[model samples]
Target chain A: MSRLSKKERQKLLKQVIKDNPFLTDKELADKFEVSIQTIRLDRLELGIPEVRERTKTVAQNAYARLRSVNEGEVIGELTKLKLDNYAESYLTTTREMALQKTPIIRGHHIFAQANSLAVAVIDAEKVVTGSAEIKFTRPVMVGDVIKARAEVKEIKGKKYFVEIKIYKDSDLVFYGDFTMFKLENGGV
Target chain B: MSRLSKKERQKLLKQVIKDNPFLTDKELADKFEVSIQTIRLDRLELGIPEVRERTKTVAQNAYARLRSVNEGEVIGELTKLKLDNYAESYLTTTREMALQKTPIIRGHHIFAQANSLAVAVIDAEKVVTGSAEIKFTRPVMVGDVIKARAEVKEIKGKKYFVEIKIYKDSDLVFYGDFTMFKLENGGV
Candidate 1:
């Protein structure tokens, strides 16, 4: 690939970091075919924090928005929630959540992010999984950022039917149809 | 509940610890309506390690049995795995897996455990979840030990049907039926 102009590279760098905040400066340099100093200067010029700082800020913002579910319960950081309606979460696959043999993120972590978002979107005291139909369309690797969205499709009495879809950079990686059971007021 | 004889209490203590290695001596004392010292003595007499030691042993044993899948990908420690046949795993709910408002374990943790075990049981270079039907029969609290079992019920071409069940003690807590698709050899 031809070398990108400084302006074009800076713009692309911002987009890349937004898409995957876990990419280190070295990786960015390799990907952009630029020096590490160039990437750092570009990041500073764009007012983008370092990768670790970016991740922490994103996680804190997501944690602050948690409403129906506990901060700890959600597999990923929750980015949005509208009770009994819609929810969105963000998960960055880490080394700890990847396979040792390969750096690929495990399927279950994706499922957990989807399933938990489905539960978190419910307006109830307690929610449990009744059933789920899930599909993984692609493999996700470590350092990938997954954005999962859950929409409550229907509610029949105490049962909620939710549709969850996960994406990595505009590509669908996973989706699930989840049926959740909501407990009555204050019941276990 | 009535008070038990000394021998009965000791036996029960050992069994309880086996089921939930996270329970502290004080918690056991509270449950048994005895002093902490008494519980410690009982543990000593039964040759049972302390809670932390018990947890470490279980985790180590589970980690030792892992194959084909990354150790970090599985939510619980894998105790047994027979590729394309059967698998078993153990999880001890920690404070991080519990709800802030309530100490009950998050539903997704249970789902992750079952889902990962289902993926691990497949005999393939790569396995992806195609769909799943899951039910949470009961709430699991913090400090609880969850044991999950997955059995491959059927295999057809590239698709494998798996049944996963999770239990807290003898009580069934969750169950799922998963359909997984195996990728062709060396396919991404």
Candidate 2:
């Protein structure tokens, strides 16, 4: 593809980073066909930190507002949560989560991310999974960053119905419907 | 409880070890109110290996028979697997899998063991989770050993229905019903 003009590239840079915050400066420069200095200037002008800083900021904000689960209990970094309404989280497949013989990511890691998000979206003192219907559309590999979004579809009595969708750069990798039970008495 | 006779204790020892192979010899001795040497002698008579050896034996056997997933893809050490039929696995909750503040085991780790076993029991080249219904009966803690069993309930075309139950020391901790999809063409 042809190189983008400076003004157009700067406009696209913000969108690209927003979509995938893990991209390194070198990668951004290559994608935009711009010099590293120019890419750095664009990022500075946009008030966007480096990839690592951006990741840390997102993690801290999400973890600070966590309610349903402890800070470290979540399988992924929660980015948004609306308590019995909707939630969003992000996870990067790591070497430990991949098959030793094949570089493919294990299915459980993907499932865990969605399941935890489902539980986190519930507005209750205690929540547990009652049931789930899930699908994996594609096999994810190590180093892939997954963005998972969960929405509360219904609430009846002590049960919360949640729908979760996971993506790797707009490709649907996994989806699930989870029924979570809330503990009103807060015993277990 | 009152102490049992030697013969009764020995019989109970074997049963306990069979149900929870992760129990150490010292733990067994404590439970039986016997010396550690007596426990060792009983294990020898019963033809049972030590805890570590038993765990390795179970893992090796399960990994050898694995077909759908790679050796490391399964969440826990599989003890049994019959393709399109039934499977069993074991997992020990660790510090990393617990809530940082409360030390309660995270729900996803329990779900992962069941979900992965559900996928591993499928007789397919590429299997993916379609949906699941699950329930967590009680909160698990670090150091708890969970044994999960998965049974294939039905298979139609490329869809598999599986039922999973998880136990911690003979107490049901979690249960799930899973629907998995198999890719017939095996592209991704």
Candidate 3:
């Protein structure tokens, strides 16, 4: 093996931590054949967070709960109706949209698919978005046959947590948890 | 005065409340000479939330307090030297990176700005993101001297809430509150 310079060693250490986040510091130190302090310095230099801290924070905001939909038969038809709600909608591969082979569609069309379903989840006549946090895990394109589903997760003081999931066939594609507020009748 | 149809009235009502979120239903009803219920229906049909609910949610998230900084001069100098501790680095728009001018810099650059600034805020030996929820607010352009500032807002267990604010020419542009976890020293 070629002798690694300090800069090269540090870069390697950073890459190791980034690629394998679950690896413990002691394990990393042992693998690198370096002192623990050296590993620590490498981490500090590279800005890799501690395991416990990173895991806890990620768990706090992450609302990913995957479940099978045996109701695909019903969901499929609902998906078509849900899509028709948009001003103009279609299904195509990611390549189609990326290549601009068809009329360009706005990103909001996808957003509205998830949004309209979330809006429908509120049993109230008037629902407003109190807080919305979404994570786009993958790129969505036409011909994906994406199915959108929203479920009520939390309810407190006229506020509700509605989890919306978008799936391409059976694979999970996009997920978001929207916190909505039910507006009072005739009240602002 | 021209007589407006119900559809016209509803459209006007939506425009009014959307532009000025501070307006109340009663005030709108009074201005439009319509019943309170009419105004509420208009809001419900248009998917507009009440101001109170939005204000309350904003307060809970502590974003309302930061709103005061929107029009003021925010500091951009580094008080600590941890630049070498980051895995990535780059400049981003004060607003959303997606809104930046196309065929210019890559989105990775904007992601790096938030990531590096977040690394700097940890004040730890190493920091990495367990999860993050980023929302683009506005567009950014080149030659914009962006000052990205990140602060450890909340610390629960090992996860830290790193709030990042990007400023361009003294204007608050991009704001991201990322949840980062602290990793063990020397851990990969």
Task: Specify the highest-TM-score model's number.
Answer: 2
Q: Model 2 off-target regions past 4 Å?
A: A1-5, A26-38, A70-72, A82-85, A101-103, A121-127, A153-159, A181-188, B1-5, B30-38, B45-47, B70-72, B123-126, B156-159, B181-188
lDDT of 2 by residue, A57-169 (tens): 77787677666787766778777777778888889789988645456677778888988888777776667677676777788889988899999998888888899999987
Looking at model 2, residue B25 earns an lDDT score of 93
Could you give candidate 1's per-residue lDDT for residues B43-68 as a string of tens digits? 99999988778867776765555555
Model 1 residue B12 CA deviation in Å: 11
Per-model TM values vs. the true structure: 0.68, 0.81, 0.29
| DockQ preference between candidates 1 and 3, better one | 1
Each model's lDDT: 0.80, 0.81, 0.49
Q: Give the top-scoring candidate (lDDT).
A: 2
Each candidate structure's count of clashing pairs: 0, 10, 26
Residue runs of model 3 more than 4 Å from their true location after superposition: A1-109, A186-188, B1-188
The DockQ figures for the candidates are 0.41, 0.45, 0.02
For candidate 2, what is the DockQ?
0.45
For candidate 2, the per-residue lDDT at B152 reads: 89
Name the better of 2 and 3 by DockQ. 2
What CAPRI class is candidate 3? incorrect
